[model samples]
Target: MKVSIFFKVLCVVSLIFLAGCTQGSAGTTVEDSVSLSMESETKVDETEKFNNDVDNNSEENGDNALKMLVNWKGLFYNPMVCSPYGCYEIMNRTDYTGNILYTDVVTRQRIFLSPDLSADHNNSSDPSWIDNTLGGCFLFTMDDTLFMSRYNYEDTPGELYCMDLDGRNRQSLVTFTDYNAPEGGIASDGQNLYMVLYKQDKQWLVRVHIDSGKIEPLKEMGGDAAFLTSAYGDTLVLKEIRAENTDSEDQMESYLSQIHTVYHYNITDGIETEILSWQQDKLLEEYSGEYLYLLDVDKESLKEVSLSTGEERMVIDALSAESINAEEIRSLYPIYDNHLIFDMGNDEGELKKMSVNLDNGRIFSIDPYTESLDAYGSQYLGIVGEFGDEFLVTSGTLEVPMDGIDPDGNPMVVDMVMSKLSVIKKEDFWNNRFDAMEPVEDVFLESMD
Candidate 1:
């Protein structure tokens, strides 16, 4: 009976040990499964987040896009208006290094869209300075193709060339035999490029087809006095300067010198109308719709003219006002219909920007146009152009790197300030709720009371 009891106790102990081992193994398996599931879920969440970010960026690009064409280091002139593709700017280079660069307005990526037409810049005196100024090249794009006019600054004439955006399949369009004034202007309407052709004693408005390279004379602009400034749509704007030198002993010779008149010609209607006329002065600074703003360049007065009615009135006479001098006003550019971006030249010679309402003659000071930034060296911020809801800016240092070497051939550097390009958006730029030190409503109320 005692031997039977001992065997029974051993069997029970063995069963208990087996059950405990099985339970521990099942617990480990369950734990491992749960850990693996959590890891898989985490990876899926990360992938989904990445995909969502991409989708959001695509959507934002589809809506506004905010395209801009920019050049670095202030090496090129301002580009043409932004197109659906991009903008074309002259890549300032030496004589043998002339090339046009295409910049994606949205991405700010630049691509060389022209072949190296640079001649030898290896002149003994400052070889790098040769062909370094590309201010003579003009670029415009149509239908994924770029049109470039490369010319020497000494000679105003240029050669027009057409090529793909990637600088492929280049073909010469037209070569002006005579001097082509830069002020004569070059404009494109997708179908044809209208440019001023100066041959001998006359100036002709010629239109060249992009695909066929056919040149057609559209209108005879005028003599040495009449030349084109800019073209909008089917209308061409020309400036006519006439010298009025009469035999008057009392009149000053400089006073009877030259008169400037701005005229508008319709390409479709063939009608010529005078927009602004002044005696040795600029009557029109800028225009919108049927209204044109006239700046009394000599008198420092602001006036508006109606093209339809021919009525004119003074908007502001700065000389008569006490707040600011007319001479102190350095620049005035319109942003919207009723607002202007005014630059007041301060005592430090820096341009201070302020917003002015044309209707009420109320002025509101904006934030300091530029901000000082401390980088590796000194830096500054600059305001470029102010659009309706956006403004272009640039920031760069005043220091010049590797300027020139002394007799010892050591690299020379100097303190200089330059600016790079950027864009900022301001939705309330036109509204009175803008972040201005002085509100428009408060100014209006003070004037009323």
Candidate 2:
């Protein structure tokens, strides 16, 4: 059986997502707020239930406004998104059960965005993962509206939603009962939302009209595992992972050399323009600009390519002090706050994160475990979202040797579990301010054990 741990499996490049026509109105009554405040000093047993207070209404803009909708949120670990006011996260959800919380960054005041959505959680066979045959922030936003398609990986249906930033004027857009979308299969243009969805056997690029709430299928994705990365201007970047023959006797070695292709797919017409193609051995990252970044493990160089002009600039190489042992690099992510992040594996194949500063072309290591120990007494899993120069991340409470053991014996773990969602400023993190991270006290959806 293949198990996908929420943290290490999710990979993405950085984004400038919010791209949509400013249209749409918020409706519906302002729902009541149900607050479930946890005792920050108390420790709950693993079996103790955490309550969700989803008593109101709210929404997202269009889908494209998100830098990493499905990618940013660790949909399975700690689903979160940030707005100018603060950040909204699917909190207190464990085992696919939770509610949304809006926490003000400046005031730390909290509110609810949805009612207990535990019943709505898609508990598929693979309960904790998205069906990204390929995968972020799981929801996207337009000006003040939110759009989300809820689905898990198996043969489940997906329900689309549109809402306001405050959880008011929410709309149940549509439901893909016949198809479920991989989280990365979502994007937006002007006023429409685009998605990649598949049923039992095949995949296709689909579109959703914001005003009419219409579902439109535009193109077919071949049988290979495919998904979208982000959208820019009138085009969405599409990527596909194809199997390549490496002329090696070992099948596993061939699988390691996966082929990847990225294209600028125009939303106006069904046109696809090739941008770059490389093997899985390379890493790709580009932030808000018209440039695409790559960590060429094979060439032992870091390259910056202009999307419009196809100009490639060498940023790092074997001779540079930032030189990396290409074979040991596992994965790379999009630039966030001008820092290019990548994962490098140790001799035992354990992955650790490293950061590259584009301005200075200097390298720094991001030790999530040590960082977590300083803040949550847990292990940092992945990033949740970026809000006001700060980032909210998910960190797992250290697991007991035997999960079925009594959970009450560990108060420190319990406190960390309650506040598993931690927030740290991008500047603080870059400066290695691990102690500066503060935990958000959203309860778990289920037992951590």
Candidate 3:
């Protein structure tokens, strides 16, 4: 059960802080401000009062209602996709075209949802034209708008679209062979929308109402394969996966053993329940809000379960907190409201970040005082912002190391990981407030030849 191993430990700490940059760009983009304008734009009114004071999102007014959630660092994954009405990047023009570069977390404006959106456009048959989203696309957000599909997973009919978190009303929203042809991708609990279709080869579970878009189906599974993952209220969570074939002769073993299970279907009455089945060496690691955390790498403990009373507790045990010892957990950041950010390895191994307090196991050490952080801070946060609920807009990556010599002269160095998109606060992180962080330095004069 290593699925999403915390997004593979935040993608191996963003590939050791971008040391392989576009080997899948792990966050960083800024400066597309494009001469800001849209009426006296003092940088979108300094991020428009963090989206116009929704009572500072309350965690006792310290921040909570998810201040327009970019939480889990604006998830969508890969090449970027943050929202509260800004931050959508994915660029590369040659090596098989691609483009979609927006950015406006409050008027630091920059556009490219097409050869011109908010600007040029003679409609090259617009479906958000840029040669029709240049072959690959997937940016999402369900009921609150902003979508761009066409990153299809085969079986044809695929296509869905939406917009208006400032990117205007670009339409087109139906066609997965007109509903119930899904292939595991999409889930929502904000009034319905959950999928996993297949039909003749069996596998349904549809549901799509959000104001009557109607699309039904409801339940059938039994052949396994599921996988969608999150959706609360009246239930939806999934994951089936099975695999076999292992006569291991140990070379670090693993010729195949998977298993996995985790259930929860019930969109009103399809009942499916189950909550957690595994394969051992535990790791599961996700599905926040109603809990399901897990992690037990050789017993350095940390768990949660209870996706609805499968019970199970113990959060952090291998020498329990005081600045960390879940085996110096090298990285696990992102768990907003119940707090929980991670990264440890002191004792001169440097890797900082740490925050914990998952309902009061208290433990802090985010040392904020950024002059663009790096007196050995290594970076890996995420939220990237303009009043991100009021401060803590993250995205990070920085690992510089350069020394060289060849041809008979010896000495080498090369670690260089640069890509950041910062914005942290709360006294710039509990009172260390120098510049209070804002690492947006921009780069991508386009590459991938």
Candidate 4:
């Protein structure tokens, strides 16, 4: 009996990973080894996902135009190539700047919200190249008007600029004296805008009355780190990660070690309730009705936590018998109602799309890319957004020419990927078939330049 190429490669990868794991201390426990392995595996996945955004064409003079093929009004996503450290650089390593391009799904038109919003690279020797200051922006539409806040990490604390959808009627809304940075996550209730402000070990939930320009700090959320997950309808969800000092000798180092906890705060009732605590390095967030769903990528499972009782139950397991291909799911985005769209890729470099019924735990494998669209053949990175009974998705791959020179006169070719935006009817998607005659447009935006 002979081992297949796949198995051989898998074995080699495992061996090399184990060998690298031994570089730690000899007394490193099995738990630590497993944790390190999981972290390393996550990094490898991120690298692959990062690589999928490249465009392989060697010529740099091609026309980079986008198309408009959909007229569905809903929340469309401007896909950004981001990493664990910060925004992923395209073109070259020296190019640390990246911008998000938003599309008005209703008008089938693209919107350029900000020009100078970018990530600053902190000079860190770590292989991950963690970003000290990631680009921060709060973008959302309310009452037919778009409101955005562009905050530069390099600027002073209280420098947030607000603007409209057409880049007109811009004004400075807030300037910080010495608060922690705005997480760049914001939510609005048609009347007021909400944001999470943090300064070392403290978090504050605040809202700015859009018309009056009155800013009020609502609550002091105590955590080493906090994220404003979602703000919609009447409820807001926040995920807080706490740092506890394990080493009494060095109190500062103890705070470096942390655990995660989630909470739900109701704007109507003015009540903040603790929901669930996470064990793994993953963070789960998605609010639906009376429950908030939790997704753990490392565990390949999704759980639903009750907002009232603080109880949780596993809903879907990507590695279990019910999943499509039983493959690890990545980039799970929630559509309207109790539906979730996720990406699935295999070792053979094949990308797939899967949707799960959050209410029933049923999974459907879909191929909305049936219409002679540009797939790049290797991988399909799809971004699914909801609009009524239809979905607006942008699918494509990253390509690297494998030959080029860096700006600093060094030999380097960077990864560049394009997005092909299209619209799919909800019924058509669940039927496992896409109509070829339908409008399948390519989204072009000036921000990619």
TM-score of each: 0.56, 0.67, 0.31, 0.55
Question: Which run of 10 residues does model 4 get worst, by summed lDDT?
Answer: 9-18
List model 4 lDDT by residue over 1-449, tens digit each: 11111111001100000001112332222223334434554323432221111111111111221101110111123223211111111122224322334333333332222222222222232111222214443333432343333344555454554444334455666666556435445555546766777654567888767677667888887766666664423666677777666556786566546677776788777798776776434554555434566777666677776665678787876646664443345455434435666667778756677777877888777655433223224333343344334444443322323333555777664444334444555566577555521333222222234
Q: Evaluate residue 170 in candidate 3 and report its C-alpha lDDT on the 0 to 100 scale.
A: 66
Please state the error at residue 263 of candidate 2 in Å. Answer: 1.5
Q: Which scores higher on lDDT, 2 or 3?
A: 2
Top-TM-score candidate index: 2
Give one digit per residue, the lDDT tens place, for model 2 in 191-267: 67676777667877877787887778888876267776655556667777787766889988878778888777777
Q: Find the 10 residues in a row with the least total lDDT in model 2.
A: 49-58
The count of residue-pair clashes in candidate 2 stands at 37
Ranking by lDDT: 2, 3, 4, 1
In model 2, which regions exceed 4 Å deviation? 1-78, 92-97, 109-111, 114-138, 152-156, 245-250, 253-257, 282-289, 349-351, 368-378, 381-383, 393-423, 438-449
Clashes of each: 15, 37, 7, 15
Query: Best to worst by TM-score, what's the order?
Result: 2, 1, 4, 3
